[model samples]
Target: MEYARRFPGGARAADLLLCLAITAPLLLPDHDGFAPTGLPLGWMRIAAAPLLALAVLISRRRPVAAAAVPAALGLAASPELHTAVGFAVAQVTLAFLLGHRAADRPPALWLFAGVLGAGGLALLAAPDADFEDGGTLVANVLLVFVLPWLAGQGMRQRAELDRAGWQLAERLERERHLVVHQARLRERARIATDMHDSLGHDLALIAVRAGGLKVAADTSPQGREAAEELRRSAAAAARRLHEVIQVLREGDETAPLRPAGESVAVLVHNAKASGIPVTLDDLLSDGDALPPMTERAIFRVVQEALTNAAKHAEGAPITVTMSRDGRNAVVTVTNDAPAVGTTPPVPPQNANGHGLIGLDERVRQAGGTLHAHPTAKGFTVTAHLPLSAGAPATPPRAASTTREHAATTRRTARRRALHTIGLPTAGITVLLLFMALNDHGTDSSLLEKHKYNELRIGESQQVVEDRLPARQLRPEHRPARPNGADECRYYGTDPDSFTPAYQLCFTAGRLSHKDKVVLSRVG
Candidate 1:
């Protein structure tokens, strides 16, 4: 907005008026009245005001040039007056602006100092009727020159601080943008990995069939059948690849939906079509409603798991399971583990490292967990995704309610006896052990003792209890210490929760004088 752009205009205008006010007295005719001793103090008044006004007006636009003109005028008019006080102020302001504009202009400062010294000598040679003593002259010099120089120095320091703050804010914004960009790139790499794993085998099988068809273009019925199947499978694989590329290319939240009838079942069919053995459990009914994120997450996990299995398992049978209860969906994939000491196929040179890691991140971001490990009999990947909404409402539980009421009556006496004696003792033990072990050990200043003290405490305190309290033991007195020498260890914590537990550790030691540390964090 125009209003925002000109927000500082009023302040700048006020400064211009202040600059003019300082020189307003100079405009009065014959204001520089001479004393009875024939000494003119009024001449000093005449030159000081106008020079300051000129310097102030152009200070921002052309600071050095603005300051220089007034300084030159004052120096030329120096003999008539003992001091061009305005010129001294202008010179100091010029020096400050010059240093800030191009910080290495040292010679400019020295040159100004030499000129000041020469001017002071010339003033001392003049026949002056005032300021007789060295103390008086020095006091005058300090008031006229030193104060403005100091003011200019303070302004320059403030400007530098402002610039530093702006740079820091800009750097943080750039870092945030870079992190989002990297996440997007990692997503693309994951899609590529999945495509390579799933489609590569089908394409390779098609290539084999194509070779056979080319060799037996004559009357061979078996060869013709193989060639036709190869063409159909290749078309299907190409269609799936095109779908994935479309998703990657646009990256829009509202891009086109997947083609009708494309699903994990179709993917399994494709794998089987390529002559790989695969078994699938269709646990969810066709009528089940699913969130897009959950569906995409499920698809990626299965794709990656199956691809990895086919690549390394040497044609081992793959088992895929999908189950959806009212409020949760689970996917489990398992395949025979490779024989002992069998090396995995080295991923091609263009393979990105985001395959499994991306799948894990996607599942976690959707409030689920993905687990992958080598079982005794096979390799397995299992994911449990929570439903976005709670479970569907149950029908009116008239019969269930009557049965529950009868069960509750039968168990009331036993439940009462158990809680009356068992719960409090278990709660007390849990409280005591938690207070003793968790409080001091989790404190930032005392965290370094964790390896020894915490481990010992956990071993000593582990015990059986019938019931336990639901409340968490609070570490009330532990202070947060980030930059203290007494802090013994850093406790990595949940980034979302700012509270981090630390262990006892010393402050980071300083480097020796022989070592160098760059001031910039870039290093």
Candidate 2:
């Protein structure tokens, strides 16, 4: 079924074949018996039947127009010819096709109803017709036209329901994929937070402990120098580890750095204390007035730029600038080229080379932009952070909100399934029960009392009529020679039933033979 939906031309071709099947019967020689006779235009009217059948065949593409062709042709053909079974069948098929194939229902239904009214009037006025009475004609029209129209309507509703179900399933599938992807992202964020909080703190403590060991007086002079080198290296390694952890915590709820509003002057002072030749141009004297998130982003940006400059451009003079431009806080860090004989420091093993990438994400989360590139003399890093209070401090969706949205989507899908599937199933069940109760068959009580062995030979016809109603007898299974002196058979079972049935044969109005027979079941 999914494959067929992908290529709908195959289904349209099948519908075309069905239209041909319904129309081909009207073009046969049997339909010519009802053709007009003893008139100069009789042959033309006979030809119109085939032409109308051809029009019905063309209606598969244009249902509304095709439906009108047969109806108009039928009304123009002859009032006497309306009694023909082929004529009635053609109109019924056209009515069903109109409702089944029309893109819109209101117009199709109105057109069909108009055609039915015209055809019913013609059928009633038909000369010497089987349905001449007003009540009989109305009943006939209801059976032949209205019932088939209702069936077509049901088919249209079912098709619409199937399409809606397919669309809903597709939407739900996409939502499921989105929810799963969000969950994976949240898990990664959680892991990043844990690593930064535990591992980062431990690395900082290690650097502090190594610095204390270097200044202790109990150590020898050579050991003191070695401890000093260890302390310097450990401090460098700790700074590199912090950059890596910051990158890992890009999309996490909590910032990897201290959430307190740290001063940019303090960040610059620390870099100069680390033996780097640096200069600061502070434009915001009172930096504590800025939002905590904006200040944190600015501090991290300057810290990373200074660290990179110290490692890659040793002995280079660096400049740091901070200012407020309209609604934004702009920070730029630039360093001069290293001396000709200078060599860059070796990067630590723990570095993942994602420091700048993580910094960009952090700046973006704070509604800011960061740019880092090499100049003719040295490298420069610049960041612009929005000072607006409305700037978002995190990603669009949090873990809690994503889970709630997924749950809501699931509940909506369940409700849609119940309305679309459950309601239709219940309606069909009720219709089947109504049909069973109203079916033209022998009552259960009659079948229980009249088993095959109970009827004896030579019983009068009047005697059997007392036990079973005449309407319960199967006409097709009746005796072949009822007017002859030969035995006449009357089967006692429902016409549509497959159970073991009883047959009573009468000759000269008296029961002559009785037997049990198994009826053939229709598929």
Candidate 3:
């Protein structure tokens, strides 16, 4: 009720601890009698059982002073045993605590069947009240009336299963922090749309070839070799804008495969310096010792398939390849054919360049697989990867063959870590010298007579076959020895004719196929 008037001293100390837990179970000793019924206990039934348990602890903050002071101090109290069991357990705990209070309006089920049908008709109008003791008045109306309505319906179903497991664990931790804050705002809007389409198409082709080399500086030698090829393509687009701002300020949390600044024959001679002819061939030599995330995921799947074949097949030739084998490395490429009547080019859809979705998330973060398609005679791509021993694809570094291949690759990685640490330290030194010679009894005095019968008297399979007679396992029988010519019982015997020994000792072995007869001439 407005949080019970902002907690009136915790609602008067929860109405004096619910009037001392309902008169401390009616001051404990009245097992239904106190001089049969002189009745009125001393201090007026302990001040009418704490004023009928503080009128059912202020029935939800005074439900009409909790129904006229616990039904007129339990119908003027003088009957007996703590005024008929503390006024029928504070009148069924003030009608199940004012039927769980939302500022109460509850009292109707014919007002608890006319107040428990007028206290079961004034308790069968008591003339010394034991009307055939009707099972002690139906066990005092189920212990002072339906055990507090089944303990207030089991504390309202365990407070609605602890408020539905704290609102389903706070809605699954707010949907896992809203899917990791929408994948870091989609990787910062894909590196700001690939740095605004590779530095706005190389600064608008070096500002239209520096305004046609300042109006043909002293008249065109092919516009000063196309304005010194637009100042060496704007100083190689300022070293690819400082290698894409040091790979977007070093983010893929370290995708560093650092060496080959350029290849696949200098990326098909820089895609024939963007005029797109390409062609390349085999390549490897220290392909950055393999894993710098598998050579930066096959060099961003061949730089986004040669920047989508120079922005969609502009003079296509393409080809490339790269290989390996044991523990794969592939790479492919494809291109060379779609120019005849020009119709193949598609890849330009760019709602923020995750160029072919960041080359399939950099070949699945280097756990490889890239693909791309289209090829009847054009557009391809591909990738593969997976290699590690601190990365390896080495081949062409020739300074004295790169110090004799780095001293034969550090003596073949120190002979594979000394043959994998001398095969498990010689198999744990032959299992600690066969468990220290089977614990001191050298080879076998029946393993020190089964470790002195497992420490004097136990483990009985007949004291382990009388101290292990060669670890006794001989009972599979065939004993008709004195040259009786019928010895073949290694399980399924067939020595000519003991009719598989009366079908395995009289069929106990479940004889099948006309019940056993594999006896072939062996007399």
Candidate 4:
């Protein structure tokens, strides 16, 4: 029921409600007024209605079980059942649901095969009814049970294929959009990077020229003062340029946080110079022991963490800790609480979206993990990069492996179907053969009409023995004599049933009496 909720609409609840409502009428007398077979109509319907409802209840998650419940009960009850229309109806619905709702094919396929074998077993086991032959029973079972289930399975496969096709289309569409988006972001980052590097170098050169002018021997006091102001203004413009660049390159994963050759210690020192009260704790077997990618990832993690601290927990005492644990290089950047209340800073919308996303990407590419969360005091960012796991394992070839997996699944399903069908059918066949061979009746004992007419009243025992056939009958199949006699022998006109047989009595080695031919009980 819960899984069916994924199907859509308020009708999910209505399905069960309607099922139960229909079931409510099972408590009322069957309007057809047919004689109750064994249990009353209400009680008989009760046996199966709730089960079908339960089958519907669990059809989504346990489709195979839903199919099995009615199949098993119906097969077991087939012998006593003069008509299986009720069980057949339930079975057909459940079978279709089995196929339609099944998430996988093998289970339902095997179940269908098993139900078939169970039906065969029921054939051999059910007591023979004169009105119903084995052929008709088999036909009914296949039509109302197996065929409908198979139809449902067909629909299931078609629906699954349709779903798969749509999903593939959706994924392709998403991939196309992602590729376009990433291309645009890359082009923007390249522009941003070029602007930052070229413009930043020009501003630095201008600051240097102003400083030279400010300190030159030929320069006057007013001139030096003007040069000094110019230098400060140029420096401020450079800082503003950097801030603009940070926002411009917001989601750029490839964009560098700082210039190359700067170590984590240098970054910490720079943060300290910025007056953020930063501290560094480096405890490692060797500082430069990590691989290049992992080292780069570690740098980005610390860079992102420090940036967050500055933005969100400004003025907090920040601690940058580096250590080696097991095969992982652990780097943690945690900031103490801000001077404000324990409440963490609400990050600017733009800032919250990108920096940490880049950090996560960087860490994962290096075959590691990144975690950033707030603590009671403030916020923390931690990264664990493997020291010697090498690069992440190469992804398997999905196209080729998919085909191989499909082939393997098909093979397995075929094997299971054979086992499911073969075992029970074989058992039933052997038992049936055993029953046929063990039967003890023959035509030799049968009394034909001509033989019965050949008999004479008070015929000599020798003549009667010569005319008599050698059929044997069970005591229960023999007819009751009107008058008691010393010995009576029953003979069948046909070797199968007991009716239409002859009974002969003999006394003193002579035929004393001959009973008239009569219909008798079957053997």
Candidate 5:
């Protein structure tokens, strides 16, 4: 059944042949148009074959119904069908079809056994013309009925195994997707927690300091009102940020809080009001309408750059630039070095160096990149934010991608090596073993020359072996001369014999000459 799904065209052709085999016997003419029982096959009997074949064709989706109907009809018509070869073939084919198409094995096996028992009894009651004895009847039933059933059961088991393998693969793929999704959610929650805990505390302190300065006795009325507004806004922003972090922690789909559509122009104005000399070059007319997250990221980058410049390089002039290049919104901020011979302010020792790092993470989460580096004049920070919706925020590291590709290539090479080299090497070894086992020339007894006196030059190696008792010879230690002739040698058992060894030289399977070896030791 699995094979049919894999190759539909072939399965359809096979099904066509099965249906024809089952039905053709019904339409076939009996010998001389008469049954052996001297009974004519009426229309009813002839009609039964096609109906049974139709039932078997429908059995692919309904195996039980097909099996029962055909068995009942065949039994009613068994006496007339016993002499027809096609009837036996049809019965066997129906049994195989039923077993192969069964939805469950246990019930199918019981039904199959019952059908076999019924078929055996019917054959015993009305034996075929050729089967004059009970023994032949039983043999026919076993050969025709049981064997096909076993083959169909084998097919059913194989189909079930293939189905199980397919289901397992699908389950594993789903689990892999779920695991990756969970990892991304965890990373987002970690980022949210860090921003709320660290940056939110810093902003809260700024609000309190501004509130204290607003009520001082020396403050002017206009300045006091501005300070009061800044304090309230900062405090409200901090509270809203806490709510956003809580939503992220609970994995809610609610949108996080964002700044009130802040623009680069507003950020530049704030930096100048803070007493840091700054200039702006705005080349983007649509900068204010950027996506909420992208605009927030840009505003934060500018603010962090101005703050870093004011703290470390006071009195240095800073320049901010904004423009749209292709689909990216680009921003760069640079500050000049302090005047010559002017001492720069020293940074505090308690600084954790997380300002630039946090800014970089924010830009990346908005599907952008950030670069901060020192220049010959002073320092510069630049960022690029993508405008496309749903683009991946975090780009994969190049090193990791390369390593994954290398691993995949190694696995492919291993499989190729097994098919290209391992299979051929195994095939050659098997062939060599087959040749060695069947070769008569490898026999040890054929290498011995016991009757060397009867051997003569120009005789074939086969003739020499026949005349001499070729026994107790070693194939590995065969002698060879420089002129390229193969030699076989045998040592004499007698220690005092004048001729201690006999040697026979053969050139191209024909005996060429013989020699005697005399062993003598030099003292």
Candidate 6:
């Protein structure tokens, strides 16, 4: 009903091309007559062109349903046009396009089955049609119809897979972009939260301590004046921090507010007191205290490493080393393997696997490099911090595409191209080879005038056969047998099977009758 939708310009063009192909076999001079079942040749030919054209137009939208049109038309022309090479060409072209155009895979396969069934039925319906033997019948069906349909189906699958691959790639890229954006937001939030809890608390405590010293009675007048200024400056710094942060709280709503600005030594001592075998090897007694950023970086590295060790390597001794290497301060925290027969509970912080991501961001913001990897016997996390304030860098963005992904795509495309082209090419080559090696349908030298004149009606059957050609006329080109002949064999007078043929009949092991039969109309 939707004429506009069903027959667009492109569909019209394809219909024109298909109609042209359908009429091609009829136009040949060798095919002078039409075979119509229960209908005139003119009527069926006029009806079939438009009907088959309609089927071709709808093949893309409805493959299985469109296939029935060709089947009905083929049966209508059976034993005559159905036997022509052009008829097979048109029908097989429809079958191949049906497979290539159908979107659903099951229905494409069904169309193949439908055409194959129709081809077999067409053979049975046209029992008088010429065929060399059983093998030729089956081979023709497979070669002309089944093989082309299968080739189309293979091409369709390859195209669909290629589209699916592109869709998957696009989806993964979307997910990657979203994940990267969310990670950046989460890491920045954690950094702000961490600074407020630890560094802000330290500033507030220093302001409180300066106020106490300024009011103490044992303090000298000059020391009191200096302490007053120190308290005022510390108070101003705390106010500025509060103004920027706008909200401050412990790491968790219920987590106890531990003393702020605890040195790395204090962190190691606390871990030791908590039943973790921890040792601190401090070799920085002679150097000036590290920059605030550097010191904070070191504290977080040790704290996170110790927490991980307690959670993963329970009861294992940990060594926290702080040594100066060149202008950078190096901190290494290593924990031995966990105790045997002990399994640690999985941690929930990095459930999304962003724990180390956050840690790496924290160290990078403090102008430091962090490395955490498996050791020979345990896990080790090392941080290298520049003692002087260096320009901080954000974590590098993840690559949007990789060489491996590109390589995989190229390989898939190459494989699809091969399947789309190679299958049909290989099938056609084998079909050609099979027909070449197995085709022995008609003998041109059988019914020569001289040979035909020498044959006698009362001759012995074996002697007649010996004198005649071994190859006989194909069934379709053979004419009706004369009555009372036990067996009839037709032979082509010329190389072309459609020319006039000689008919020989044998009865009771003796030649009984002979006649001239006209199998085709000469154009």
> Which candidate ranks first by lDDT, i.e. highest?
6
Q: Who is ahead in TM-score, 4 or 6?
A: 6
Model 5 segments more than 4 A misplaced: 1-18, 25-45, 57-62, 68-84, 103-133, 164-175, 197-218, 246-364, 368-523
lDDT of each: 0.54, 0.63, 0.52, 0.68, 0.65, 0.69
Clash count list over all predictions: 13, 0, 10, 2, 2, 1
Ranking, lDDT, top scorer first: 6, 4, 5, 2, 1, 3
Q: Candidate 6: what lDDT?
A: 0.69
Q: Which residues of candidate 2, in runs, are more than 4 Å off? A: 1-12, 27-61, 76-85, 103-105, 120-137, 216-523
My TM-score estimates for the predictions, one after another, are: 0.36, 0.40, 0.28, 0.35, 0.41, 0.52
Model 1: which ten-residue window has the lowest total lDDT? 514-523
> Among these predicted structures, which one has the highest TM-score?
6
Query: CA shift at 294, candidate 3, in angstroms?
Result: 38
Q: Candidate 2's C-alpha lDDT?
A: 0.63
What does candidate 2's lDDT look like per residue over 1-523, in tens digits? 2322445587566545555665554554322113332132345446655666566557767777766665565456543334333455666776776666665777766765675576567656666555544444455445555676667778877878867876776677677657555544443453455445656677677767777887888988888788778778777876776676566554434454443334678777877898899999988655547764576678778877887888889999999999998888999999989989988889664223556655766666677888899999999999888877669644433334444664587679769989998999899989976864434233331243334456667778788656643333344443334343455444445433534556566787877766656545311
Task: Please tell me which model should have the higher lDDT, number 2 or number 3.
Answer: 2
Cα RMSD (angstroms) for every candidate in the order listed: 31.1, 22.0, 32.1, 17.2, 21.3, 10.9
Query: Please, what's the RMSD in Å of model 2?
Result: 22.0
Candidate 2 lowest-lDDT run of ten? 30-39
**Shift of residue 35 alpha carbon in model 6, Å:** 15
Could you tell me the C-alpha RMSD of candidate 4 in Å? 17.2
Q: Candidate 3 clashing pairs?
A: 263-266, 263-267, 285-395, 286-394, 289-391, 289-392, 290-392, 354-358, 496-519, 496-520
lDDT of 4 by residue, 65-98 (tens): 9778767665555533323225655666777766
Measured with C-alpha atoms, the lDDT of residue 443 in candidate 6 is 30
Per residue, candidate 1 scores C-alpha lDDT tens digits across 173-196 of 666556645654666544454444
